[model samples]
Target: MQNLLSIVIIGIGATAVMDLWGALRKPLLGVPPPNYAMLGRWIAHMTHGQFCHKSIAASPSIAAEQIIGWVAHYLTGIAFAALLIGISGPAWIQNPTMGPAFAVGTGTIAAPFLLMQPGMGAGFAGSKMPNPNAARLQSLLTHMAFGLGLYLSGLAVSLIC
Candidate 1:
């Protein structure tokens, strides 16, 4: 129970940090935040046995996609946190080091590059986007931020727990 609580706290904290970065990036870099509604739509379609789309934007909209997307976002973050804990073990959670946290956080980019992007019709690693290189760079940076968040969150958890 303690370990579970620690994982959940760490995950939410890390994901919140990543979200903070996104909020800051908009005004500072003129980069728009991701549209989670599309993610929700994609997830909603999964219930109907649809995993891939030619263009998620062009696909039919689902009810409460925004809410669903945000929930999925947080759940995904929690899952990633669990993955980090599973790989690093309970000892790491107690110690809260940066190396392992970063390794797991940065490694998570594969999900979007291989599965989420392609499934949403953005092509592999956003290759189909108008600015593929830019998209790739953004994704890399975002994941790195997530890695940093994981480390920071881990540190917080270590201090608290």
Candidate 2:
């Protein structure tokens, strides 16, 4: 139960980090505000591998993608917390140590950089975008934010719990 809460918090924090990362990197040539929610949804859809990809805006197939993505996002939150609990055990669940939390955040980079980008037809890290370098930098920053989010969420949970 507590582990579940931890994941929820971490996921929220990850979203927050994503926002900050985008704002920070907005000046970068090719970086766009990454859809952190998309990351979440991707995590969720990975469980099924059914290509559920949706966004909050209007585009071709946006509805299917967004719904699947939203569900996947929440699932990612749960999964992240579960992994943290598994690694630290129940005792840590009560007071998640920072290492595992940050590790989880750091670990989040794999999906976008490797799987999502290529799958989205962006090559790797927005290579398909006009400014691939800026796009790649945006991705890196967003992932780093996710890592920071993990640590921040863990700290919050440890303190509150």
Candidate 3:
């Protein structure tokens, strides 16, 4: 029960931290925040046995895509948080450290680089992006930010516990 609470908070906090980075990227790097609705469209298509697309933007819109994207985004965060604790042990929640969090955050790069990007037609490591290097950097930095978030959230949760 205690671990559950910590997991939820840490997950949401880390995810929000990633979102914060996305928000700031627009001003800092001239890159707009990601459109989760596009992710939603991708997921929606999955329900119809379509997993890959030439361009997610060109994909047809589905009902409640925005809502679906937002929900899935947060849920993914929570799942990642769980993964962190699972790998680092529940004691991580009691005494959070940067090592595990950082490793997990950076390791999560695989998801987008290997799966999400290709599935969304962004190519591996966002190679299909207009500026592939920039896209890759953005993705890397975002994941790193998520790691920072996890560590910070764990510290906060530890204090509360």
Choose the strongest candidate by lDDT: 3
User: 22-58 in candidate 1: lDDT tens per residue?
Assistant: 8887998899988899999999999999999999999
lDDT of each: 0.91, 0.62, 0.93
lDDT of 3 at 107: 85
Please give the ranking of all candidate structures by lDDT, highest first, separated by commas.
Answer: 3, 1, 2
- Superposed on all Cα atoms, model 1 deviates from the true structure by an RMSD in Å of 0.8
Indicate the worst ten consecutive residues by lDDT in candidate 2.
54-63
lDDT of 2 at 37: 49
Q: Which regions of candidate 1 deviate over 4 angstroms? A: none
Candidate 3 Cα outliers beyond 4 Å, as residue runs: none
TM-score of 2: 0.67
Q: Assess candidate 3 and give its lDDT.
A: 0.93
Instruction: Give a tens-digit lDDT track for model 3, residues 13-47.
Output: 99999999999999998989989998888898999
* Candidate 2 local lDDT, 1-161, one digit each (tens): 66666667766766566567667765764445656445544445555564433331221333356566656655665576566667767576456566776776667767766777665556665666667886666666666677676667667777887
**Model 3 clash tally?**
0
